[model samples]
Target: MREVFWQLVRFGITGGLATLLYAIVYWPIATYAQKTWPLANSATWPVAANLLGYLAAMLSGYVMHSKWSFRGHGRRDNLARTGGRFFLVSLVSLGMNTFFVWLLTGPMHGPTWWPLVPIVFFTPLITFGLNRLWVFA
Candidate 1:
């Protein structure tokens, strides 16, 4: 129980860092894409930008999670296997985040920035569960 508590703490710290990295990469690229293709605001532009940002952060997140967050909790003998798991979880989470953004900003006609609400909040919690139960476990 204490271990789970400490692991969650590490996950929060690492997740926060990765989320910041994601926002930094996302805003500029997403802004540019939105500008370049205003008509595609409903999906293409945002999804692409989110994918790019997610991938960038996933790399750093994996290292932090492996070396710090879930350190000593699992076997790190083969990073390839572990990396595959991490990447799979991240990809799924990316798809989820992209869809939520589209739903909020496009169909729902919410504030353009409103998508960040789900991205910054829900997606991390979902990913953390997956990482804790599957990826890092």
Candidate 2:
């Protein structure tokens, strides 16, 4: 349907912006940590940094989604419910991203880009459905 198409478009744009924000924040911190600390070989820190960045970006995305994407859908009025749903879904998405990245990087012997690809491709789609049906609905 047209509604779903438009929703996907809006969600894509918002998700892209949020991810850009997260990368901007994450890269600098990750770079600093790698450079400043002696644990240059450690991969876990970047994962943690990514999680923090995602959380920050998710907050911005939630506000944008409430005002733009789900506006007038009768889902934006309940601040408490909206906030809770956003946080819950965001956390779950983060967990999924982490698990996926690990699976790709470890089990599949995939390239580093492989992990990032799924996060961008899949997480937003899943998050949008959750927002529309449970959070904002």
CA lDDT scores, all candidates in order? 0.83, 0.76
Instruction: Output the number of the lDDT-best candidate.
Output: 1
Total clashing pairs for each candidate: 0, 0
Which segments of model 2 are wrong by more than 4 Å? 28-32, 105-113
Best by TM-score: 1
lDDT of 2 by residue, 7-122 (tens): 77887888888877877765566446666776566465457667777888888998888887776665556688879888999998888877876676567766445656777788
RMSD of 2: 2.4
